[model samples]
Target chain A: MIAALMTKKEWITNNVRRKNLGAHVLGVTAFAGGHIAVHWLMPSGQVVQDNWDMHGLEFPSLTVELPEMAWDEREIHDVFGYRPQGHPDLRALVRNPRWPDEFYPMAGLNAPQKPPWREVAPNNPEQTVEGEGVTIMKVGPTHAGIIESGHFVFSIIGENILHLDLHLFQNHRGVEGQLQGRLIGSVAPLISRICGADTVSHQTNLAMAVEEMAGYQVPDEIKWQRILLLESERILSHLNDLAQIPAGVGFSVANQKALTMKERWQRGLTVIFGHRLLFDTVHPGKSLAMDTAALGALITQLQREWRPWRSLVQGHHGFQDRMKGVGMVRQSDALRFGGQGVVARASGLTFDARQLMPLYHGWHVDYASETSGDVSGRFKVRLDEVEASWRLMQGVLQRYQIHSALPFWEPPTDLIGQAATFSESPHGLNAHIVAVDRGKVIRYHVRSGTFRNWPLLSKAVAGNAVGDFPLINKSFELCYSCLDR
Target chain B: MGKSIQVLQLRHVDAGSCNGCEQELTALGNRFYDMQHSGIDVVASPRHADGLVVTGPVTDTMKRPLMQDWDAVPEPKWLIALGDCAAGCGVFQGAYACYSGVASVRPPDLVIMGCPPLPQDILRQITVWRKTLD
Candidate 1:
């Protein structure tokens, strides 16, 4: 049986040929009950989702045709024990290597086998390009910097990188597995903490899904307040990346200046939202006990500080030399890797969930662009987004009125259906799909922009100077922890 | 306030944090908190550190690396569990991937309790500890 969302056709569920469906896959997902849904972005600028019911726990491999679907399908295999039959290169993704191959965390502990650890396997170097003068370098699950845990296997000839194999999920904290069977509303805090860099996006996306499930309409005051938090958070996250890109180039002056600005912004956020990372600011239905006047003051203070600092860093020739034309990601590679947010826009793909998803509909989102798809392009994208976010924040703040509502998600506690939500975080498109059964979360899956954009880091790194990894990575500024979640 | 200060160099091990703690820990080096003002620093390697700053709930995958990094610190080194998750696992108590708290790996000399403790709080505590060496 085949179902289609293209050509304005209702999902026709019947025995139909496989070749009838269109290409250009945006993402592939498995909802509750192992139903594989393929979202296709058509030529008319409309996204159409086609879903397929798996016969038992097996689905035909779509990765054979669409490489972007690889991660999604691999994740489905790891968590749900659903095998993607005939797929090439199915390996451990969400699961760490130490876990027994049979231990699928999403299978619910009540099923036959209980969750247990197995003895660790010996460390084997991951695959690399092999030939004369080719050397392999491995850097972190630990690094020289105050950064998250992830490893990179780079194959290089002299200073130029031949290829990069990124080994992630090294710190897989089992966030999705942990959320099972918890009350729908109770999981927002945990969701918010999925990754500090993406706190607001995670919470807001979850809130949207749960709100959809409960048929609840957020009041106008709270809606604007939520937008305000999202934009402020966007500024903070992007600022961290801006500071990082400079440090990659050993430009301490710009790095420290950006860091100082970030700290100032975070302190102001704490004054208004009660959390540094904007956590707890976007819980379902609930409004904050906020200082609305302080919100205005914070925005004004940051704007006063931003102008001179921006020009000083952006104009630096040393920083420009390191970033421009380094680590270029082809637009073709961007599309193949399921590029979503910053990377896609920088690489000349006009695919932003902000513009494409219903979650961000009606909001005027102005994004930055760079056709070269180089390190400088990604850096400029973040720099531009910082201002775009500030503008969006001011628009919301101008319309914001103090809302005195109580703690918020699904209050009626009778949520029994499935809903998916998306948000354009500072990182790009952050997504969450949740299914509640009698008020408890039965199935939850998160696909962050980082999860989608990580492969692009390797794609861009090839042929660039090996030392360029840090600058290239910082330019994209993808979150390791969010994807680890 | 009259006593001379000795630097307390530290290395950070992100056992399995959601990155909220790392965000603040990194900010400690920025101009605002400036842990360096107190002669406290986050060194690149454990071999140069006087202590370990551990965050997250000790995920199963990170347990060995965390122990290896902690062992790399010179003797007389202390471990400070830097967040609610590291101190006692906070929201991740029964998570399958987590060992619950840093103590489950090795007991910490100090536990600073914020989901991610404020950068000021983190610096103040480290500065206070640096005085203990005097």
Candidate 2:
């Protein structure tokens, strides 16, 4: 007696319909024989992976009902040539201007030949909105500052932005494609470079997935240290953005002060972790010996430094005046957009990935982060988060000191398989899905906090003054390379 | 004699970095390293710069804009490749989307090393390069 097999679309629809509204879309990606994989997070911190087949047609369109699934579905279409039937604007997301037509890099085993380098990778048939007094303004592929390359198409009437569109992936070096057939252990350095500000978080998340595949249960003592490293990264990343905000409003004094704290912490990270950005703290088997005295002193120094800056930032009328009531994303719009991390939390939709991770259990930390979802709200979220991160680090340090002599958990070299994991990055919830076969990584997919939240940035910019775009942009501080990767 | 010569101005251009170089590059202007005191400035426009301090593996999509920045700068402008990726593509060498490094696009007059060379290293190399202007 054969059981009936329903279509992948129906299965997803049924799941979406039947669930008690606790379900959230994590990501969607196209893989080899596995076709399309839909990642879901339940209210109970459980991750459900639904494997959907293509029914043999190469360019299959798996239309998604949920609005947030549009980005992931379009990404699948861009790189793998799998069309998302219901996705409205499927203009190139990952496939930038120079990416040749009909060349799907990730779909086939053999990569296409390198096309001739051109003087201009023009956005063919660029998207435009025409109306009386609606002026088109193009900002960059190369910006006015030291920022990474990305183009912004702003439709404006005087100072008001009507619609904001962007051109990202100018820096797509084909990381996932390059990771194919590489040894799992050797991929840490490459992963760390995915983005600079969140280097530690990226490496830690990758380590979690790899260790899962290798069947390694990391020791509590070592896990605490990893958490501390991640929290420090959060503080540093928040500081980086904090500094940029002041720069946006021409508040150089505040900007310099923020830079001072950031620089001090990064310099101290080198002394403690052997890498300024904590890029060297990847391997878990080795016991890292950080001096207890230096750790305490550094923590104390940061606390002393951060408190005054925090007060100054909060009290400065000029700075607060510029940030408040600007770049506002209404709660209803935020929910509809399905944003995550700081952006979502600022907008009052509370879902933190830390609640799902087992490493974060047995601690009494406030997970509820709510705000008005404006530039100032994002500012307060980052400020409060930095404070929380430092305290979390202090707790981890205390625990590590108590269990200094515990045996480290050695990762087993014998085990193999795949795992999808989620962890909180400084930007928001960061997801890494990996599969290992014969000592090599066969498939790697990352759905960053930036990928989902970028659209929200455009949404926030709408009906905002064009001059305030930088302040709004800095408030989000999204990473272009992270999404492009 | 106090200082009499005009300071050098280099515009920083990110040609597809992972942004590690950017972290160090941003640090150059802080109170600690203080590139401004050393008679070096990171200008807002390529037209205002004496050199283009480039980073990353020079991804194909960024190649044209990078060349245009070079065209915008005046004659006798130097090119500085400021990390391992820009120096020789580092791990990103020969990837489908990139042109090895800034070297493949245009040979750099100066090259700083390290996955991201430290803020101190980047400043030191540029300080040494600052000597050649005389």
Assess each prediction's global lDDT (C-alpha) against the native. 0.78, 0.79
**Candidate 2 lDDT over residue span A219-301, tens digit each:** 77677777778788888899999999889999998899999988999888888888877776867454467775687688899
Estimate, for each residue in B1-134, the C-alpha lDDT of model 2 and write its tens digit. 13334777888788889888888889888899998898888888998888799989998888888998998998768899989999985777656777788988788999998988998888788888767766
Runs with alpha carbons beyond 4 Å of true place in candidate 1: A1-27, A31-34, A39-49, A109-114, A121-125, A356-363, A402-410, B1-5
Off by over 4 Å in 2: A1-4, A15-20, A58-64, A110-120, A402-415, B1-5
Range of the 10 consecutive residues with the lowest summed lDDT in candidate 2 chain B: B1-10
Candidate 2: lDDT over CA atoms? 0.79
Measured with C-alpha atoms, the lDDT of residue B28 in candidate 1 is 87
Native contact share for candidate 1 = 0.63
Which lDDT value does model 2 have at B19? 82
> On residues A1-485, what C-alpha lDDT tens digit does candidate 1 reach at each position?
26543321232221122213322344466655667776554444364556777668887776665666678888889877888876797876766667777777776532122257776741434879999999999888877778888878999999999999888887777777788888886898888888888888888888888787788887777777777777888889888988898999889988998898898888888888888888778877777777777877887888788888789877888878878899898998887666778888889977666666554456787878879899888888887888887777777767676645543544677778876677778887777777788888877778788887888888888999998888888888888888887
lDDT, model 1, position A107 = 61
lDDT of model number 1 = 0.78
